[model samples]
Target: MTAPTPIVLLHAFPLDHRMWDEVAAGLARTHEVLAPDLPVALGEPLPEPALEHAADAVAGAIRATGPGPAVVVGLSMGGYVALALLERHPELVAALALVDTKSTADTPEAAAKRRQVADAVQEAGSVDPVRAMPDVLLGETTRSARPDVVERVTAWIGEQDPARVSWAQRAMAARPDRTDVLRAFDGPVTVVVGDEDSVTGTDAAEHMVAAVEQALLVVVPRVGHLSAVEDADAVRSALADLAQRVHDPVA
Candidate 1:
């Protein structure tokens, strides 16, 4: 029997690999799943703010597994790293699942806002500046119905180091557009978004889907930017299906 394909899970910003705990656990039953924390998410000291560095780390993790390519699943900031990894180390990725992320670079205003937040976080010497992010990151439905999830995300943000938060914000601000990279990739692609994801809503998801020739778009209902966290089972189901397609294209 053939070995199960490897699956690399990259997490969203302000949160570590723990964000993928549920989904990873489910997928691990059928695949070789690995969820690596992006730079600073786990309080790792990064020399500079650059998603490229994070992508390099991810590439290294993938390489450590074996010679073959792996299926890459990224959410939010993780998506940026995935695209960067694809551009810088295309041979390492066999398929992609970009969730709650966009393909375009940040707008000037958005980038500036990120820098401003970084400055505040650095000056305060605390993650306080972004402490309220869970409110915006989560959907109205979740905020109202799932207090546990809200508390969970808030706690995760609180655990991040202030300097790391600032570094991640700046790093995200500096990322480039990678739609072309997606367009060039002929591998199967899965684009997932929460209907209530105000951050990078359906529009962003659609843009990514349009960029890729073979893409599956899943618009999960009633969740927000953190679809994987808010609706792990939905996200897990989508990923499992994507893996099947990757492992058996004809099936």
Candidate 2:
């Protein structure tokens, strides 16, 4: 029997571990899977000033498993956390699947917008960003046509904790550019994004592809920001293939 590679899946911001449920189920047959929620309250307050909280706390969850290395997959905020895992917990990350995320740090204008929204949400509610996020993240087509996708996102947003969202926003605003993490690593990497993922689109995946030595890029069609929900089958296939490449490069 082939030894199974450990798979640790990190979810996007505001959403919880459940976001990876379908994809995890697909990868489970061939690998051991761990999915942890990233609620600020659930873990520690999202690191102040930058990604400080992310590297240690989130990556430490995978580290606690006692494995030398594991394939780490993350989406959006989850992708940020995955980069954190690679940077601070290199020994614990054998490979990486960066889904619907970018390697560059937040731009000052973007970071300022995030801070402004974070402030407004503190006074209002996390739901405000949750509602508007789909517009910014998803393509115009997905927003107009996909009701099920819309419903799933609505459910996810409704469940998030406001304080957690507030903290994560600030954390994201302060994170350093991690493009070097991809360029410097000597390991397998895959960058997956939905075809219509405006928030992190083909451009982001292309940047990632250029950086990693052994990397694959996959873009799911007719989907948007939420690939885990919008194009889960595509996501599953990508992860399965990535796991195979990591486990047996020749196979």
Candidate 3:
């Protein structure tokens, strides 16, 4: 029998690999799932504020898993890193799942806001500046109906080191557009977004889908930016299907 394909889970910013706990657990039953915390996560030393650094970490993780490419699933900031990884180390990726993320670089105003948040976080020596992100990161349905999830997201943000938060924010601000990376990749791609994800909603997802040849777009209902956390089942199902396509491209 053939070995199950490896799956690498890259997490969103201001959060750790733990954000993928539920989805990783579900996928691990059928695939080798590896969720590595990005740079400065879990008390690691701060690296240069660049997505390439994060992508290198992911490449190392994939290499450690053994030879051959792994299915890469990245959410939000993770998605940016995933695109970077694809551009820098294409051979390590068998397929990709981009969830609640966009391939385009942040606009000038958005990048400026990120820098401002970073500055505030560093000056305050706390993750307080981004503490209220759940309001924008989560959909109205989740905020009103799933208080536990909202609290969980808030707690994750609180757990991040202030300096690391600043570093991540700046790193994201410095990233460039990678849609061409997707256009060049021959592997199957899955684009997932919460129907209510205001940050990178359906429009962004559609843009990514149109960039790739074999792309699957999944717009999950009643969720928001953190679709994987808000609706793990939907995300899990989509990933499992993507893995299957990777395992049997001709099927």
Task: Give lDDT per model, in order.
Answer: 0.91, 0.80, 0.92
After superposition, the stretches of candidate 2 with alpha carbons farther than 4 Å from their true spots are 39-49
Give lDDT tens digits, candidate 3, residues 1-251.
88978999999988988889999999989889999877623335676799998898789888888998999999999999999999999999999999999999999999999999999999999999999999999999999999999999999989988988899899999999999999999999999999999999999999999999879999999999999999999999999999999878854
Candidate 2 C-alpha lDDT tens digits along 1-251: 75777888888876788888888898888788988877323444434635656656766666677655788898998888888778887888778999999989988999999898788778886557666565665566667888666777778778877877887788888888899987888878889988888788899889999998778888888878888877788998888887777778854
Model 1, 1-251: lDDT tens digits are 77877999999978888899999999999889989877723334566898988888888899889988999999999999999999999999988999999989999999999999999999999989999999989999999999999999999999987877888899999999999999999988999999999999999999999998779999999999999999999999999998888778854
Clashes per candidate, residues 3 or more apart or on different chains: 0, 0, 0
Estimate the TM-score of every prediction: 0.96, 0.92, 0.97
Q: RMSD, model 1, all Cα superposed?
A: 1.6
Q: Please give the TM-score that candidate 2 achieves against the real structure.
A: 0.92
Worst 10 residues of 2 by lDDT: 40-49
Residue 215 displacement (Å), model 2: 1.2
Model 1 accuracy (lDDT, Cα): 0.91
